[model samples]
Target: MVEVAWPVIHATQVEQVIAVFLSREHPHALRITPSQGDKGLDVIVEQADSTYHNFQVKYFATNLNSSQKRQIKKSLASAISLHNDKDSDFDLSLWILTMPWNPTTQQLGWFRQIQTDLACPFSCEWRGLDYVNGLASKYPQVVDYHLGNDKSRLEQRIKDLENFQRLRALAGMPSADSTLVPQDLLTPLAEVVQAINRDDPHYQFSVEAGPYAPPAVSRPGLIASTTIGETQVGPFVTFHVYARYRHATDDRPLPLTIHLNEAALTEMDRAAWQDAIRFGSPVTLAPGSFTLDIDLPGGLGVTNGEGTLRLFASDLQAPQPGPVRWVIVGPASWSVIAEIEVQNGPATRGVAGGIEFEGIDSTGIMTTRTRATPNPNGTFNLNVTISLAPEQELIGLPVAQALQILRFIDAYKPGNRLAFGPRWEPIVRDSAQLIQIDAGSATALISFLTDLNLVSNECGAPASVPNWRELTRQEFLGVRNAARVLAGSTARLEVHESYIAELAKSDIEMLPKGEPVAVTMPTQFELKVAEQKFVLPFTEISFSRITIESSDQTSPDPDRGFIVFRPMEGCEITQSMPYGAEGDDSLE
Candidate 1:
């Protein structure tokens, strides 16, 4: 029996386990991820008939309760809304509420009541701990990777490692592993042991199962899969096998036998394994579920970035649901350090790394976090969060920026502020609010809404605000420009200090003087504004050449002077709004 605590498992792990199960059972039908902001639908299994079986997985450590019931309802409502949308991708036929733990008898009643109260247009079902355990009995690899215990395959691997360590310590081998050797076993016994370890190939590895398609989820009918396992093979996994043979040892390292429970090994994989016997680039001989790509820093063997093995379990979409079974059989020389598993699919918001830009304005906080993950396919997954503090951005958000924020305002929620670093680790924390709305917060929104020319400034009866779709193209253009400004992080000198008032009509602009020595004093300069041109008198003028670049600043007292000139306002630069047939699709 798999004696593992169900509730303690992370919600993400629970989701992956179910996904793996569905991927096996429904292989072709298991859609990767259904929705963008995934509110209702978590796992979508699209059958050949074009009908969808949607599962909303929840990691409720405890029995079903009122709060969970409410959550379930909300999720159902959201999923229904998606289905109602004409543009939606799938035809919803069944709704599944799945969790890691079994519910109590009373909890089951609550679940049934929820299903009945919703009066769902589609069939509804529940899957709990028993469902997962049933799958685990057959797919033990899943448990060995995620919910492992003392009696697990993972445990046996650990025991093997401990035994190896005991023997190594008994032999009193050096803490470091080495490969350089010219003599045979005639060297010291300890030296012989070290030499054997170098050639004997002590290595570990890992495997990650993903879709052959770039994103590995969402789209249906792609019908291909890939299994990537990495470990050292040539040196341990490279071409330096000659070094291993240098010291007297067994004939050669035994070739590893990789197994995929479902798909047959592709001819490419077979050829790759054949090449492995010759000790060519072993990177193609991916076999195990979890194989270390390289030795630890300063550990031993041909340790570098180039050492990695990749294998494939490619298969077309099968007609019916089945489990994904991947296995590895290696020689005694190559030990199973661990058969690790569990990972967030492409849709997971939690990222391996991310970037952030934040600033404080009027006691209100604003943050923009962005993460882009490139997929094997040309397309990529981009996650961006533009959050505002005091959430409603009351006092003043740039009018243009507020318009953009208002577009996706529904995604915002009220919460304390927190920041994450590149490693996706928390770097800052504060009572700073994520968002909220009230007279205080809405004050700015209200004033800005008035700018829309929707309501009258004259205080009177309350009226309905204009819809967001009602916004003009120019308004959207402003938002687009603002987004570019934030994303580009570019700056230019657009303004200058003031001078005389009599020159108010003068068209003034500054330009860098390329070569000072090329010209002397009394040089005339022409300035143009729009179609009109203006010339300023060179009275009391001085030139500063070094001001243009650092290399010119040869002296401590670099040239410091100004050539003052009057400037006139320029004509507005305008482009037609992208709203009609002639609209630009570049931004899209």
Candidate 2:
């Protein structure tokens, strides 16, 4: 008999208990992870070595509440839905197991009252070790379902759930939700249910014989690691890991360990060494429950201007939840080996290959640097550099390897530090990504800014701290001229009193320069793609020499990515208007 232990187990426990019995009692058998789309069951056993029985597993908290009862009802409803599909004629036998006695006074009454209302191939049984003696006394054949037995499917399922839950806690996302038979899979589910519904197509399904014997349980295995986020901190690298597990008891701390390649660790650019420890708030492992978190680092903004950290895990040890490795990228001058062992134990060369960044920050913490610019055509150009400490050199990192390095470092060592070299390349498009600016039109400019809700600060804030007086068209134009100084990152296309000083400077610059430049001022521009439209407004007309090769630093590479416009032919400029000047929608 299957012996399943956990903080909770839903219907799947009952399936395992039954599997244990059938595996021994019947012939021509093999097991399959039950319900390809069903999350509740661990596996299903069939008679002809083909799909037949649809089993489910469930984990319930000791304190059953109205909500949980509702969930159970929901799960059952989904099972019925699956069974009703126009598929095979396999009979349905769903089993739900708890720690032992379950169902509150009200719930038990509800279950008793609603038993008939529940659909076919659906049944609920609540029993535990205490009931084992009843089987031994009356039906010794069901002994396979007992908990203490080896090779029991129930035991294995419990183990698998335990490990699955543990890793899930680290990943920080919910366990895989119930497998809704997508419309595509509905046909298959239908065929399976059609075969099991009845002996004759006209006859109704019947569970004439009571459960012949209890099913066996199998030990569930440890879950694999999942990566979360990665960031660079000078030379150090950090990674986050997640997995899941099932617990056999309550409040019991699960012994865990992490493994990483030592060679990769020693070769990583490490600023300094810090103790390795768990990365997040501690959690208690409850039976049948699964948890998830930011399992492996790679999380945005987890690194700083320090060193990159590299990681590796020990392959020999059983998997557990925790940080695996934390290695700092060292300086370029240092002499470090390419490989090392886990916990400084062994070494491997391939692990050291990957791109890495290094450098010193303005704060004196080591950091890396990279340059990025937008193209006039609206794409981005990125220059990234990777640094490695003496320790990171042995591996002579590859680009993909470098990504993993950043993940580990960011997870363990986090800060508002800068990254240098190739690591700092911008992944996002500049302000031009969603909007464009037109040149030399006042109404266009005003409408654009209006759409964007942008306002400038030419007139200083009135007596009110946050409110600034609205500048007139001329004043707003002047503010646009001085925007470079008045607002750097803070500047938008509108006018504000706080920017008055900068606007004055701009006014002076715009009057006249020694050489004649084809000066054009920015107007508001709007774009429509599909059904959605976006508007951009600007006060200043940014002019550039229309180079033979489009000069938009942020524009996409013409050869590789999309380029928006063709080479500019001589064009007419019918208008030289101020910020408030009105104009027809059609360009003259």
Candidate 3:
């Protein structure tokens, strides 16, 4: 009951249908005309001697309407002219083959009268959809060739087959040697069997009342029997036939009830399932290390420089299936680096110094820069600038953690170095020392020193250390020497090069600004100098002869400041003199 769009049917399919119909209806019919150059004739049949029959296959979306009839008449006229010009001696019969539609008696009579009035040695006939449908019914291949089966039904059948194959393979069963029947074809066979096996009274009573009826109920004889085998693989039982059937009839319904143990099926091949479920590629990275490279930034010789390099897997928790290798080669590079700790928002700010370094920021762009101070003995000082905004601190606590990792490279090390040919190469080491070099403000310098544990209070708590103003010049010198030693040992330095650079870079904007007002922390005042070298502990050091500088670039009132020093029990101040004053000075 499906209505087909006849207009969408290709002309080639119409020709094929006609050819197939003719081959079956008239086995000896010879097709003399080719499809392309046949004028109005699609196919030609040679009858007795000189008699010929030609068909013009016409498929229409609807019945032969007025417009369609006119088209057909024009084609007929063209055919008549071609026949007269080329084959005048032959007797020709023209036929218009179309889809199913019945014409009125008047229309048929009119067509016949027109054919008679043509005044040519030919006959005309109209074959519509009814005739085509009859041909299609007899030869169902015609319908299948034109209109395919339902796509959803085909897909379901494919899925069923795939499932069956997969399950059979999993169960380790031998595949069937014969081809499987398509679902579309098997459906009709199943319906026919169901119809014949119906429990209707007409069929049952007639068969049972016959002379060959039952005869003691036939003892329930076994018409056919086959063994159903089951093999247990793990918790699931795999059922399959082991041997071929000698003479089994499949017309009867199979007495099969398939019960799949879902849990057992899911548990099969646990390792493989887990492996398949994993995501992403696995990578192994070596721990971070330091590197010293010598470069000629200003056409100089190899200079000593130190930086740290860290390697980490882009994704660590997955397994990858390929070889892993690291390649390193480059000049120098720089990038803005910020380290943030969970407790403290932003922990550190610095720049990573390296060669050919690449890192993505929040904006998803790679940032890079390169600059180094060349020193003697192939040792160059790596100058990295770090910026800390005033607003980054919360309640006197640093926001960002201090920058720890400074530089990195992508190369693998062989022995003690990564050799990139003879011309360029950098020496790689496992560890290096980091130091604090300079600071912009006294608070910054004292904070950095306290952080390094170089400055501490009487209780030896670095956190209890007072502000910079409370510390004497001697105590400051002692703290600075301690910081220098720590820096040399660690090779790390806290510097404010970024602030200087920013000021220099924006000199035009700051030229008209006035001198900034002085700011001080009032609650913090005392700084006790801890033991330096062999000195006793808890010795409070205070600055004397304090001088205040004013914004006018001149010394302020000297009487405004006072000096006080808290000495230890054994210590005595024998003579006190201001630094750089020519006088007898001794500490006893």
Q: Estimate TM-scores for all models.
A: 0.30, 0.20, 0.24
62-140, model 2: which lDDT tens digit per residue? 5667787686666666555665666734445644443333456676677655555765455666543344333333323
Give the clash count for each candidate.
Answer: 33, 208, 30
For candidate 2, give the lDDT of residue 311: 30
Off by over 4 Å in 1: 24-35, 103-109, 152-588
Write the residue-wise lDDT of candidate 1 on 317-433 in tens digits. 221132111111122212221111111112212122221222222223434333344466744344434445655333244333453334224323333222222222222222112
RMSD of 3: 34.3
Best model per TM-score: 1
The sequence of per-residue lDDT tens digits that candidate 3 reaches over residues 1-588 is 333345567766665555555544554444434545555565566676756677666665454577877766666665677677764543566555444455667768866765566654566777766676676656443355445523244664565556555544444533475444344334544443343323211111011112221212111212211111222222221111110111111111223222222344334333322222221111111112222233211121122322221211112111112211111322232111212111101111121211111122221111221123334575644432233333222222321112111111112111212111111222232211132222133345534445335433322443322344556766665455444433332112122111111112122232323332221111111333533222212121122222222222222443232222222333322211123333211221
- lDDT (C-alpha) at residue 426 in model 3: 29
Model 3 lDDT, full chain set: 0.35
